[model samples]
Target: MRRDPEPLLNIKANAEAPADARPPGERDPYLTHLGERIRSLRATRGMSRKDLARGAGVSERYLANLETGTGNASVLLLRQVAGALDVPLPVVLAEVDGHADPAGQEGQGGHRAAEFSQLVQWLAQLPAGDLARVREAARHALSPSESRDARRRRIALIGLRGAGKSTLGRALAAAEDIPFIELNAAIEQEAGASLSEIHSLYGQAAYRRYEMRALERVLREHDTMVLATPGSLVSEPATFNLLLSRCYTVWVRTSPEEHMARVVAQGDMRPMEGNREAMTDLRRILQARTPLYSRADVSIDTSGQDADSSLRALRAQLPHAD
Candidate 1:
């Protein structure tokens, strides 16, 4: 026999209850339950509300309300929140249904979309050459203005290696008629050392000092320019936050397989030549950095797409980039 799907329940507080019947500052039980579940999952993952909001692409205020039993989060929002908490969607829905134990319900957790969210979380952690692509995506998400107005809006692209920040950035700049600058090149010129040499001789901390100086110089000198930045900029939270505060940010992304293919096609075998466990390391690095990347204004998936297509797609989305 074909069984009907579960009905969506409307949860509301009783209007007929006596004034004192409800505790002070108490909300509807269902809302309170949802809030508790969100808080529980967040605590279990060792994430603060801010961390959860960033990971889920929602605002911290919204998350706070959801946890405080005051906000009526939609189904889609609940799913995103659940995914960010790394819990199964049904686990959240089950709580809503008054079933604390999901294991007791048959096929309750069989939602493939929830499983797909897990896969996305796993893939989001993988690293490859697509970090630059994410930067380009961020840039493309912003508005492109002509005339002097273009000079007023500041933008920055930050992501991982091989994410195509430079390549796509130039195209975006040309389309918008704005100047394009390679942040790494600017850093090398300012420090008088190549990135590899800086990393090898002075270490990451030294390189970051040079990178920050270069970023400040560019931000001060050029009011309007498409900036191509290194992916590791995100590792320095203070610096990255400063850059983000000064400009609109974008994140370009792609699948691990696509990232590997692009790097191989570019004749860059550094990742492959290193440890055999490079892919695993890449995944861990991306996972650690994804929260930073999610802070961008826009995200684009550049997998299997050409530069023109990616740029055009990004331009369409960018209000000022038009």
Candidate 2:
């Protein structure tokens, strides 16, 4: 069954509730866990509270209040803290279980939790190649047979921004008489907020959660559609794997120069604003992500080509192109 958007909305709603709403002496488990998680992550990074406060753009006094579980932080503050901690927002928000219980004071639930932790530790030590094999094995072992039989007509285009994904995706879908969906737009609709607002309010982790849910809903609802995903969608392994397994994946390739040119042509100049090394940074990012993007089933370079020309080339690369 498709889960409703209420759960994600509830996270924000619950987080933003006034601290006074609780009894004067009662501690919020959620806030307590969040505070401890932040402190632990900062300690692991060998940072002081002052350091974290500066990084997060908050005052030390406010941070201290949060760590002591005496402050009610706004979502924006938490987002900044998550960014400063160099971890996803979900990690910061994750409840810290088993800490209150002493060693050997565990019930059946605790025992099972320990076993799960041990399994994760064991898996973490495996070689990269072995890990991939283990993942595939586990996936096949657990997945329903029907899930393995995905429709080939469901196409997904993945690449960096300005690679002509949106442009070519619409053309291809129109040519084939199919629905076209932009994954980011779907996420925004699901969240009831813009992408920037999502990041500003809930951080990247929340955005990622919404992204996954939106994708799942789309897949469940549409058996055959063209999905134009966000540029960084490839960075999330689970989401990308689901995409690869279910869709005819395509990497819309273009030269770095052309990528910049297209973005400029679109009148969004934020890429080159105030950064002399913008092109260099873009190249570095592209290089780092190439291996991941290369996992697509097909690739098409649209450099130096008009949208019509690119559309024709992309269409030819699709399955059963006439």
Candidate 3:
């Protein structure tokens, strides 16, 4: 009943070699070689398969298959695995290339070519607006002095309900000696209605329109302020991109457990009503929105950390703060 162990070979180098130059049976050395490199790197770092798998947000069995050269991982999966392993994907690819040819030049070219392909694939997935905003942000971050004449500093704080945006925004504002603005409060005051009433009477689309109006007003009125935004803003791409273009966004990240506890402490068990799957749903939502959250300029893990500690971490990451 024993299954055969997976074959280990250098598949990457063989693929790069000219058809006439490749040895017999050396079909695909790149993939196998890459897998071996990953395994070796993980081992060298004293990380177990399970540890690497967990860090990569994949199953241990998947990591096992990959390490044994049986799994053909996608570029995205490879990137995640590389991030978890604390090695750039190109470095891993280069290592594979090195194993293929002792001289190393041939493999280096292949690695660079593969990395360029991966970058193109990633850029293609982003929305046009998001991509443009990212480029602008990168340019500003790289050369602040050049951007200073037209660069208006804006900070948008985003997180799930009860993730402490309001509390931390106030602390951050105090620390920076800047104004703290609750965007929802501004919306409510402008509309002469509460958020729940607006959502209940007008629906989500209408509420978003109102939110956009409020955001526009804020942008025009305040040059620099810490703005707390709703978590569901991700669902509105246009509005989200507008905010991103105009501000340096920070995701006040919290664990599902911490979010649940905070909501419960506030006596709002509405999220848990009649549904045994509430906790599961919350976790799924958080996981799904992580990519959007990661687009923020900075992410601070506020779970189990006090407001002051969170504020300090935020301050440390910001470009210029008191």
Candidate 4:
């Protein structure tokens, strides 16, 4: 009797189905998306596995595993990769909003990942000036007009840790007779843990989620309040963009020396403890964040000014309530 070839063909077909070809529900969707994002980012940078591994200080095998969605990446490794890519760490770990499943149709999370990948490729070719214009245009297209009543009364103070956002924001809120909310404190309350505990136990991604939740809660509960945001809040584009769109943002800036002095005066030495390059790092951070910070509606330099004077200057710059 002649043997049938259909059985062999079926076996070959089954063997050829890759792990990714498995049912969408069978795979870890988040890890798959993360791998795709990392691979896309690496491709955009024109880096190979060897190059990226070397830059990220990981083995090529590990990089390959990550790119294939087979490796569990630690937060520290993600941070190292983000640094090597010259992007904010959150960028690596961020998911495309609304993307519950990457295998769905357009308008679902699946198309979003594709669209985001295309957008990144398109953006990589633009010059610096064009990129800035595009960013502004996107912000305008996505954000509502500045005349919203909710935005008018909600004042947000943004700056480094010791730039007097809290102290000045407290005084200003008291003078204005409105609620004053420290965003970090709100986040801690939301997470039912302190900031340090949140970061230690849940990592940066969890902290950011808590931060966003807290911000949303505050915005929902208070139509009028003064908010002092975490210094690194600006590093997360989505959260920072929301802050910019929802509140009247003011950058409370100061000299690096003054920032350091004030932090020390407040009995906080973490920025300087065991770090000889503290001032140098501070300057670098301020320099890198200047563009983002400068996007604020108003800026007040607190250097060489007393608290009362700074508060007065801030008030003068504010858009008074209707």
Candidate 5:
């Protein structure tokens, strides 16, 4: 159900459209609520997507899109899905009245395979009015000072390496007169070596340690700055969640072909020299991370777009980009 290329995709005329057409975070209220209830109940049962799909007599992809607020399930289908979760149909229907958030509205666009975290499960359990109250309390808590400009707090650009996060982030920062931070560079500085050397000498575990420490300092030192983040950042769930919680994130996306070309143009010839399945591997990464990346506050598709074009799209998404 993922857009595959854009930040969000419109429902299509094809068979896959029902699940993919509606953006994950934006779906019909009743349907969205029902989907969350289904998802949450399914999680508590420790059932995998395949298991539930088989039991419900539905395709795995349909179940996935349904859980993400993307698929449109019929009353009969809901009954099947409810049965699969071993919950009564009436219970599922009534719980749909709960009106909990489907996902982050701020993160409008898009990774994960279709799994709900414990946090999502807890959030879904709140009553209708309690959801709003909790959000209000969170707003007050997160923005401790009333006068602080939320727009100017922090804007992080996340995407595949060739998705133009670096290029667009630098331009946006220049236009906004804010600092531009490259997280990878900071990590290298902290480790006293290049990223390759750090990975080769100390391994990924050490590199992640340096990454988290560098990320903390940047968030602390700069109140307002545009940053280009590593695509692999989503692999570190804790840090990725922390990044989403603290900053207004944007997923900058482009086609896999474009990503490979851009990376090659930037002098990284490993894709061309090393792996024959480079494009396939890149596509797999994009697909696997879509759920995690969907946590971003917004998105901008840089595919076939020039610097000025992409910048304009980004600026429209974030006012501070100006």
Candidate 6:
């Protein structure tokens, strides 16, 4: 049995594009599946292709091409897509990664793997000079660094908005005599406006760009610091992964009641002033982010704990903090 090509004729980049604009063809199944996954994730996030394209720093046409399965993307481009989509790269590469498994572990399309192994073995038998040249070439091909991938000296506090990340992060920094950074504040400084203003002028996609750049600058300039991140940062997997790669992230845990109370006590009544569903939405958001927050290297329950006690507990988890 053969299946006809799936034409994504209904998906348009903009209102100006024709509804029938999708080119018709039965493309590679792997590419098609990957494209479909990307499209589906975008839809779930309530983002248009243009938004994804902008966040990924790719052109709208390229994004359209990718979503249609006609594009043969490089590893770098795939990474950009993963970042924009806020997913691990492996998710986008799942089907192809399995069938094209480099380790031959999937039991399919492994001739190249076996041949490459043989080539490596044969090279091992060669002279020292030849081996050195081959090793350099392999290094070039690998282009991976353990040190760059190593977790950094920074400590990051992650959780919901009113989870006490800012307070605890600052205290931790003060105790250790390290600098403290609030990621959203850094973003706000870079944008020269409030987060709401930035979002109003440039959308979430642009705000994420600013966030990434600000974090990059912080990491580059500071050798060690305590960073308090935005609650929703977990939604951006790439940025979060980068944080995990370079920082000991801690989940600042607190109860919903405490969260709302703290936000209100801080005089930011925006959470419950006008919006009737604010508390429900906050609950939903916290529930949704719990799994992601759990990925942190450490956790400190700030609920029912004062500033000094919470800071002491957090510091206890950090090496050499005591």
TM-score of each: 0.52, 0.63, 0.54, 0.66, 0.55, 0.56
Higher-scoring candidate on TM-score, 1 or 2? 2
Residue pairs whose backbone atoms clash in candidate 3: 10-29, 11-28, 11-29, 11-30, 12-29, 12-30
lDDT of each: 0.67, 0.75, 0.69, 0.77, 0.71, 0.71
Clashing pairs in 2: none
Q: Higher-lDDT candidate among 1 and 4?
A: 4
Task: Give the number of the best model, judged by lDDT.
Answer: 4
lDDT tens digits, residue span 1-322, model 2: 9865664335555455443356777776667876776665543332345545865889999998787776654653565566677555655554435343456577666665556666665776799999978977875555433332354678899998889999999999899999999999999989999986886687666887899899989998998899999877776777877777788899998998988888789976443455576686567557756877888889999989999999988888877733
Model 5 lDDT, residue 270, Cα: 39
Where does model 3 exceed 4 Å of error? 1-152, 269-272
Local accuracy of candidate 6 as per-residue lDDT tens digits, 134-156: 75565445542335323446888
Candidate 2 has a TM-score of 0.63
Better of 1 and 5 by lDDT: 5
What tens-digit string does per-residue lDDT give for candidate 3 at 235-283?
4666776777678889898989998888778876543555576676566
lDDT of 1 by residue, 68-137 (tens): 8876534545555576787766556542223224566435344444465565555466575576466555
Error (Å) of candidate 5 at residue 214 is: 0.5
Task: Measure candidate 4: CA RMSD.
Answer: 11.7
lDDT of 4 by residue, 207-317 (tens): 889998999899889889999998878877778888998899999999999988887898875434555776865676677577888999999999999999999999999
Q: State each candidate's clash count.
A: 18, 0, 6, 0, 12, 0
Residue-wise lDDT of candidate 5 within 109-204, one digit each (tens)?
212211223345566778978986785566546642422255346889998779999999999999989999999998988889998787557755
Best by TM-score: 4
